[model samples]
Target: MPIQVGDKIPDVTVMTMTAEGPKPVKTSELFAGKKVALFSVPGAFTPTCSAKHLPGFVEKASDIRGKGVDEIVCIAVNDAFVMGAWGKSANAEGKVTMIGDGNGDLTKALGLEMDGSGFGLGMRGQRFSMIVDDGKVTHLNVEAPGAFEVSSAEYMLNQL
Candidate 1:
């Protein structure tokens, strides 16, 4: 089943780019003692993802953080390098934490994986966002396939 409000996020390894190189980060470590605004996109650099999805979070990072969120995270089912490049290109540095779920570990665990074989994108995370407090989900907004309404940063900020 898909993860919902009140569900504790599963412990899984996700990748983040570091000055040294790509590094593994545990999901539990990310949420431990923190209120996190975590958002996911279908893929990196895709039309909608680049033009709208990621930009929204980058633009509203401060407002989201101002509402008691300790961190704003952006995840995608791509490799760490790609995610890092996208983050740099989008000016997400110091604003958003970009994580790469290269193996779909976290996505699959949350039951949020979607097949994008028709587009040659293979398996990916659906477009969604959630407010997680100390590892427990408090709010969730999942967008319908190909739709982008409730998952935007503005909407998430309003929910907060």
Candidate 2:
């Protein structure tokens, strides 16, 4: 089953770009001792993802953070380099953390994987967002396929 409120985020390795290079982060450590606002895109740089999804978080980052969220994270089923470039292009530096689930390890662990073979995107994560407090999920908003309502930053902010 997919991850849900009250469940601890799964411990899996995900990548993040750094000055040195792509680095691995353990979900257990990343979510520990903090309230994290996390959202996932199917893939980086897609139309809806670029135009709406990621930007919403980037625009409302401070407002969201002000509500006691320790950090905001954006994840996609793409390589670290692509994620890094997307973050830079979207001006998400310092405002949002970009994570790359290149192998879909974290996505699969959460049971949020979706197939996009029709679009030639292969396996990817569904559009979703969640509030993780000290490693335990407190809220989860998963968008239906082809839908964009609940997972938006505005919706997440309202829940805060």
TM-score for all predictions? 0.99, 0.99
lDDT of 1 by residue, 1-160 (tens): 9998999999999999999999999999999999999999999999999999899999999999999999999999999999999999999999999999999999999999999999999999999999999999999999999999999999998998
**Total backbone collisions for each predicted model:** 0, 0
Put down candidate 2 lDDT per residue, 1-160, tens digits, no spaces: 9998899999999999999999999999899899999999998999999999999999999999999999999999999999999999999999999999999999999999999999999999999999999999999999999999999999999999
Task: List pairs with backbone clashes in candidate 1.
Answer: none
Model 2 scores a C-alpha lDDT of 0.96
Model 2 misplacement above 4 A: none
User: What's model 1's lDDT at 28?
Assistant: 93
